[model samples]
Target chain A: MSDYMKRSFLVALWFVFLTFPLMVVKVNTLKNTVEWRWMNMLWVAIGAFVLSLLWRWALERRQLKNKEAESGEDESTRLGFGQRLLVEPKLYKPVLAVLFVATIAFPLLFDIYQTNIMVLALVFVVLGLGLNVTVGLAGLLDLGYVAFFAVGAYTYGILNSFWGIGFWTSLPIGGLMGALFGIALGFPILRLRGDYLAIVTLGFGSIAKIVIENWEEVTNGAKGIAGIPRPGFFGADMSITSATTYTYYLMILMVIFTIFITNRLKDSRIGRAWMALREDEIACVAMGVDMAKTKLGAYAFGAFWAGLVGVIFAARNTYINPNSFTFMESALVLSIVVMGGMGSIVGVIIAALVLILMPEYLRAFSEYRMLMFGAIMVLMMIFRPEGLIANVRRKYRGHKVMTEDVNA
Target chain B: MPEITNKLLEVKGLTMDFGGLRAVDTVSLDVCTGEIVALIGPNGAGKTTFFNCVTGIYKPTRGDVLVHPPAKKSQRINGFKSNRVTTIGMARTFQNIRLFQNMTVLENVMIGRHCRTTTSILGAILRGAKTMRQEQETVNRSYDLLEKVDLFKYADEFAKNLPYGAQRRLEIARAMATDPFLLLLDEPAAGMNPQETRALDELIVRVRDTEKIAILLIEHDMKLVMNISDRIYVMEYGKEIAQGGPMDIRNNPKVIEAYLGEEADA
Candidate 1:
C-alpha cells in the first residue's frame, strides 16, 4: 500500500509537470502580459493522484478476478453486472418492462428537441450494430463504413429529387443500394485483412465523399438535397412537431427490429460461420464454411442497416450535405461500437445513448469534450479493453445420457 | 480386422514447389475405407506440406488428388479451395490445433456443419420453421459429437479453455461434424501423454469401425504410429523412404536409419 501511494504520488507529479504549461501559464497577447495560475496546477496534481490510485486498484481487482477464473471458480461470478442482469430473467424482466414503458412514453413526456436528439441517438444505435456485424463478428476492420451511410442517404436524396420517391418506398431501395455498394467494395478486397483492409476501407470512405461532392449533376454537389418529406402515416397530414415524434417512434421500432434480427442472426449457422471466419480463416474453410460467401454476407448485411438508417437520417433532417457523411462520422460510429463492446447488442445501445446524448446535454463542457473523450477512451483501453460488456456466446443445455445407456 | 475396402482418397505423384525449393516431391499416398494410414517422418520431412497439398491449402505443382465418396463419383480436387475440399467429403485438422478459441466448443463443431446445412441470410433473419429445425439439428449433432469425444461436459466452455488433450479430441469431433469420408489428422498426438495417446488410438479406431470413415494421420510418436496405423508410410527429406504394415515398418532398416542414424559398420 505504501509503495502504491508513492507510485501514485510520482504519477501525480508527472501529470502536474505535463499540464503546467497549458493549465498554469496563459499568454495574454493583447495585454502583452502572462497570467500564472498555480491553483490550476495544484488541482491537476490532486486529481491525477486520486485517479492513478483508483486505476491501480481497478487493475489489481481485475487481475485477482482473472486468477480466480483460472483456478476454476464459478464462471458466473466473473460475469459483468450487465451480463448478470441478462442471465437472471427475474431481475431483467421487470427492468425491461419499465424500460419498454419509458421508451414508449418518452416522446410524449419530453419536448420536441429532446425527441429529435433521441432519434439521432437511435440512428447511431442501428449504425453501431450494423458495423458490429462486419467488425465485431467477422473481424473485418472497415474504416469506410460511413460510405454506405452516404450511399443510403444519397440513394433516397437522388430518388426523391428526381422521381419524388416517398420515405416508405425508398427505405428498402436505400438498404439495397447500400448492400450493392458493400458487395462492390467486398469483391475487390476479399484477400486483404487487418490493417490493409482498414486502409483500403478508409480510402473507400474518402472516395465516396469526394464523389458525392464532385457529382454535381445528380447530387447537386455541395448543395445537399433538402425538403425530403417525413414518413407518412396513411397519408395523414401532421405538423413538424408531430413529424419529429413520428420519427422518434419509427426509430424506436427500427432499433427493436435491428436488435431482434441481430440477436437471432448471432446464434444462426451463418452467424457462427462469420465468427469462425473471424477466429481463424484457415480453420473456418477447413470446416467447410465458404469464405467468399460468408465475408460478402457480413459486408452486405452490415451495410444494409447503415443504408436503412441513412434514409431515416435524411428524412428526419430534411436536408443532407456531403459534410454530414464525413470520415469523422464513420469514426464516431466505430467508436460507439468499440466502446459499447463489439458483438454485444445491449452494450451498443447503451453506449450510443451515452455518447450521443451526453455531448448534447453537456454543452457547458463543450470545448473540453473532445479532450475528455480522448482521455476516457485511453482509460478504457488501459482497463476495460473489452468495452462495457464483452460478448457472450449462446449456450445449449442437452439432456444427460443415463448411466445405463453408457453401459449398454 | 476389417478389410480395407474401396479407396477413399488417392494422391498420385504429388509434388509441391515453393519458389526454387521443393517442399513435397512425388509423394504418392492413398487411404482405403475403414483404414488408419500413418505418415511418419522426422522434422522438415514435408509431411505437413504433403497434407497441405492434399487438403488444397497449397495447390501442388504436379499431382492428382482424387476422392471417391461412398455413393458419389470419383472427382479430381486438385487446385480446389480448402472449403470446397471439405464440402466434397474430406476434412482436415491443423498441426497446431485450430479450434475457434473464442467460440464455445459446440459452436466450433456447429461451424463444421456449415456445408451440410443450407440457410440463407433471409432465412436467418426471418428464422422460419425450417431454419429453426436445421439449427436444432446442428446443435444436437454437435452435442453428440462432443459426447463421442468425451467432451460433452465442456460443450458450453470456450475452446481455448479446454486442456491440451481435450482440445485435440475436440478438433477430431469438429472434423467429424463435417461428415467427411476421410479425416486427415496432422500430428494429432504431437503433445499428448501416453494415456492421452492411448485414448486417441481408441477414438480413431472407434470412429473408423462405427462411422465407417477412413483416417490419414501424420504423427511423430513411434509408439502411437506403430500401435494404431494399419499401414505406415515413411518419408525422409521430402521423399518416400518406405511403405508397409506396422510389423514390416518396425523391422525396416531404412526407416531406422532415417529416424535414428546410419549404423557404423564394425
Candidate 2:
C-alpha cells in the first residue's frame, strides 16, 4: 500500500513540474495584449503522466529480458552479419570512402545560403573536437572554452586591422596566441580539479570578455573592429558569394587534419599517459609520468585547434565582435562534446550537426531548445551516461562492463 | 663515495613527521644488489611511511636517500618528485594495489616503460621510423615482463578484471617495467593464501636472480619473509626494534614482545 502511494505521489510531483510553466506564464501578442492559456496545463500534465508510465513499463520489460538472458534462455553469443560488418576492419576503407565523397559533394548540392548554414555546422564541429581533447581524453572539465576561441578571433581581428596582414599569416599567429592563452590559463588552475577547475575557467571567460570590452585603444571597445580582409586565390576575384565556397573547402580540409592528428595521438605513448593521468593521478605519478607537462600538453593541443577554428571563423564571417563569443557559445560547444561520446571523434561530428544545425528548422519552439537540452542531459546521466557513441579505447573486457564515463 | 657498483640503495637517518607526530624516526637502512631485505612491523609501525620517504612520495623531514645504480656514482635523491624517482631507478607498489584499473594488462605494464623511452607530439602523429621502433620496443618489452610474472595469458584483459592474487602479481610486473635497480614491495603477501604466498616467494627470488635487482619488501607473512629474505628489519612505534639475519631477528625476544606483549602491557 505504501509503495503504491509513493508512486502516485511521485506521479503528481512530475505532473506539477511539467505543467506549472504552462499554467502561469502569459504570452504577449503583437498588439500588446497578454492572456493566460489554461488548457496548456491540462495538455502538458496528461503528456507527462503518459511519458512517466511508459518509462516505468519499459524499464520493467528490460529487466525481465536481462533476467531471461542470464537464466540461459538465450544461447547465442555471436553478432549478426550487420553488426559484424559495422565493426569489421575490411569494411572501414569503403565506408570512409563513401563519407569522403559525400562531404565534398554535400555543399555543392545546396544553394549559397544553405551552404553557409552547413559551414556554421562545420565550425561547431571543430569547436566540439577541440574541447574533446581536455574534457573527454584527459578527463578535465573545461567550462570557459570560448575564451580560447575569443582570444583566437580577437588576435586575428586586431592583427589584420592594424598591420594589414592577410588570412594566410594570421592563421598560424592566431593559433599561437590561442595556445599561449591556453597554457597561461591552465597554469594557475592546474592544481584545481573537476568542479573547481570548471568555475575558474568560467571566471577566465569573463576576464577575457571584460578586457576586450574596456580596452578601447586596441580593441575599439564594444563597437568591435571592422573591414577585415577575406581570403583570395591566384588572381581570381574573391566576391561575397565565392568566399563561402572557398571557406567551405578550407573547413573540410581543417576538420580532416584535426581528425587525423587526433587519432594518431590517441594511440601514442603520450595519449596513454594522458589517459593514465585521468584514471588515477597517484598511479600516474608512481609510473613515471610528469603531471604538469602532460596536463599542459592537453591544454595547448586542445586550444591549438580552437585557435585555428577562430581564425577561420573570422575570415569566413568577414567581421568579428565580442558578442559572438559568449558564455552561451561555450555551453553549446560543451553540449556537443557531452551529447557525443567523450573522446569519440565521429560522435562529435555527428552530434554538432544534430544539436546546432537541426535547431534551425524548429522556429516555433526555438526558446524551448535549452530546456530540452537540460532535460536530455539529465536523462543521459541516468540512462546512457557513456554517451550516444561511446568510444571503447582498448579491446579489453574488465571484470564487469562499466556503464559510467571514464572516472567510473 | 660509497661503492656504486655493489649497493642499490642507501638511506641515512630518514625521518618523516606529520605536524605533531613522528611516523618514521631516523630509520637508517641499506640494500646491496641481488639481496632481498624484508621490513616487518605491526600496523602503523611506519614501515609504509619509510617506503614513501625513499620512493619520493613524501619528502623526509631530515636525512638522505641515495641511489647507486650500476656503474653510476651515488646520487642523493632527496626531495625528488615521485616520477623522477622512478627514472633514478627506484620503483614501489602500494599496500593497496594501485594498478591502472581501466587499462588493459599490457597497457599497464607499458606505462612502466615510460621513463625508458621518449616521444614527442610530432613523433606520435607522424608514425615515422624512430617512433615506430620506440612503440614496437615498448610493446615487446612490456609483453616480456608480463611473461616473467606469468600473466601473459591475460595481457589483453583489463587489469581490474584479474583475480585478487593475479592483480598483485600484475602490480609487481608493472613496477619491474621501470627497470629499477631497487624494487620496493609493500606487503606483497598481505591477503594471499598459503599456496599463492609460496608462488610469491619463488617469484621474488626469481626477480632478484634473473633481473639482478635488489628488493626491499614489507611483509607480515613470516614464512614468506623468513624463507626468502636475506636480512630483516623490524619496526615498532616509529622506531627500529631489531635488525639482523631473518632467523636471528625471528628468535629475538624484543621482536616477540613487540608482536604479542604490547596489548598485555596496556
Candidate 3:
C-alpha cells in the first residue's frame, strides 16, 4: 500500500480500537446478557478511514495556500466567499433587502413562539456585537461579559419592582448602568492581559451572580424577580401577541442601531485606535494612543449594548433570575462572535441566528445538539480560524488624483 | 556651533537597571533643532535602552530627559508615559517594526493622528459636521504622509502585506502623521538593501529639511549614518565612548577599537 493508504488504515484501526467499548459492545443488565455488535466496528473503521483521507487533503491544501500567501501574491483576490458577498454591494444589498422583508413579515406569518425565539436571537446579535468591541477589536479576553448583561437585567428588574418604573425609562438607564459597571470592572484589570484578564473577568462574572443570589433585599435572593411589565405604547396597553411583536420590532430596531453605530465607528479615529491597540499595545502607545482611555472606551461601549438588551430581555420574560445570567450564556454569545467573525457586524448577526435558531429548530436531534455544536466549532477552528467572515479593513480611494500640494 | 540654542531633546545621566543588571549607565546626549543625530554602538551597547529612557518607555533609575519645543517652554519629561511623550511632540518607530499588521496602511497612519484629533465616542457614532471635517482632514493628512514616503500606491494594503522596505517607510509615515517635532527611529536601515538605505538617507534629510523635524536614530548601517547624521554618539558597554562629527568619530581610536575590537600590543 502507498503511504497515504497505510496512514489511513492505521487511523481507522486506531479509531476502531478507541471506540470499541462505546460502539461495538452493549450489555443488557436487565436480561443479564452481553451483546457484541461487530458490524458497528466495521462502520466505524470505514468512517474513520474516509475522514482521515479528507483531513490530510485539507491540511495539504492549507499548507499550499499559506505558501502562496507568504510569496506576496495578490491577496485581495483570495477573499473568502462570505467576505465577497459583503464587499460586493450588488450581492449584499439585495440580500439585505430580502432579509429585511423577511424579518418584517416573520411575526405576521409565524406563531408567537417563533417570533419570541427570533427576539432571543436578536438579543444575542446585539450581545455578540458588544463583546466584539472588547474581545474582537480591543483584543481583550473578557470571560465575565455576562456580568454586564446581568447588571442590565437587574437594573430593569429592580427598578420596576421597587419604584414601579416602566421598561422604556429603564432601557437607557440599564445600558448606562452596564457601561458604568464596565468601567468599574475595567479599572481593576487594566494591567492584566490575555489569560490573566480572562481569569479575572470570569471571577467578576461569578461574583455578580453570587451577589444576586445572596442579596435578598434587593435582588429577591434566587427566588428571582417577576411580574416586570412589558414596554408601554404611549400609555396604551398592548395585547400579548401585539406586545411580542412590539418587542420583536424593538429588537430589530436595536440591532440596526447597533450596526449603524458600530459600522461608523469601525472606520473612525477611535475605532482605528482600538484596532491598533489590539494589534500591538506598545506600538499603539508609541503612536500616541492612550491605553487606558481606549481600553475603558471599549469596555464601556461593549457593555452598553448588553445592558440595553438586558432590559428588553427582562421585559420580554416578565421575569428573570440569576440562572439566566450564567457563564454558559456568556460562552454562547462569545462563540457567536468567534464563529461569525470578530469585528464583522454582519458575521455576528448571521452567527447569532444560526447558533440560536439551530437548537430550537433541531428538537428532533436535541440529544446531539451540543455534540454537533462542538464538532462544528472544532472543524471551523481547523479550517477557518478567522471565523465565518473575516473582517475586511476599510479602504480609502481617490489617492492618485490628489495633488502633492494637498497638505499645503 | 552657531550657539546650539534650539535644543530639541536633552538626556543627562540616564541610567536603567533591569533587576541586578544595569542595562544603560549614565548616557548623555542632545539633539538640536534641524539636526540629524545618530546613536551608534556595537551590539548590547545600550543605544536602544537610552532611546527608551528618552522616549519614556523606561523609567530611568537615574536621569533627566528634557525637551525644548521651538515656541514652548522647556519641560523635564523623564518617566512620563510613552503616549504622553508622543503627545508632547515626540514620536518613535520600533526596532522590530511594530506596525498594526491587520490594519490598512492608511488606517495605521490615521492611528498616529489619534492624539492630535479630538473626537468623542458620540462624535464618531454620530459623524457630525465638525467630526466629518476633522476625519476628512485626518485622511488627507495621513495620505499625504504616505505619499511623502512613496507608499501612497499601497494606501489600502494591510501594513503586514507590504514589502520589508515599504513597511519601514510606512513606519516613518505613521510617525510623521503624529506631527512630532522630534522623531526617534530605532534602526531605520537595519535590514534594508543598499538602494533602500540610500532612499532612507534621502527621506531622513527631506524630513529634517521640509518638515523641520529633528531626528535621533539608533542605527548599525555605518554608511547611512555617516551620510545623513549632523552629529554622532558612540556607545560601548552601556557607556558613551565618543561624541563628535562623523569624520571625528571615524578617525577616533577609541570608537574604532569599540567597533573593530582592540588591536594587539605589537
Between the candidate structures 1 and 3, which one is better when assessed by DockQ?
A: 1
Measured on C-alpha atoms, candidate 3 has an lDDT of 0.91
Candidate 1, A35-74: lDDT as tens digits: 9999999999999999999989999998997787778875
lDDT of each: 0.91, 0.83, 0.91
DockQ of each: 0.74, 0.48, 0.73
lDDT string, candidate 2, A1-408, tens digits: 456445745785677776676674676777686676767766765666667766776667767756875685322333334334446779767888898898888767877887787788898899999999888888878888988888888888899889887788898988888888989988998788978998998898888888888999898879987877766576477767778887888898989888999889987888888878878777788888888888888888888888988888887787887888888888899988998878878778888988877777676889998888788777766555666666655543222222323556
At residue A63, give the lDDT of candidate 1.
93
Candidate 3 clashes between residue pairs 3 or more apart in a chain or in different chains = none
Candidate 1 chain A TM is 0.95
Pairs in steric clash, model 2:
none
For model 3, the superposed segments whose C-alpha errors exceed 4 Å read: A1-6, A64-72, A398-408, B1-4, B264-266
Clash number for every model? Answer: 0, 0, 0
Q: Which pairs clash in model 1?
A: none
Q: Alpha carbon lDDT of residue A121, candidate 3? A: 92
- Show where candidate 1 strays beyond 4 Å: A72-78, A397-408, B1-5, B264-266
Ranking by DockQ: 1, 3, 2
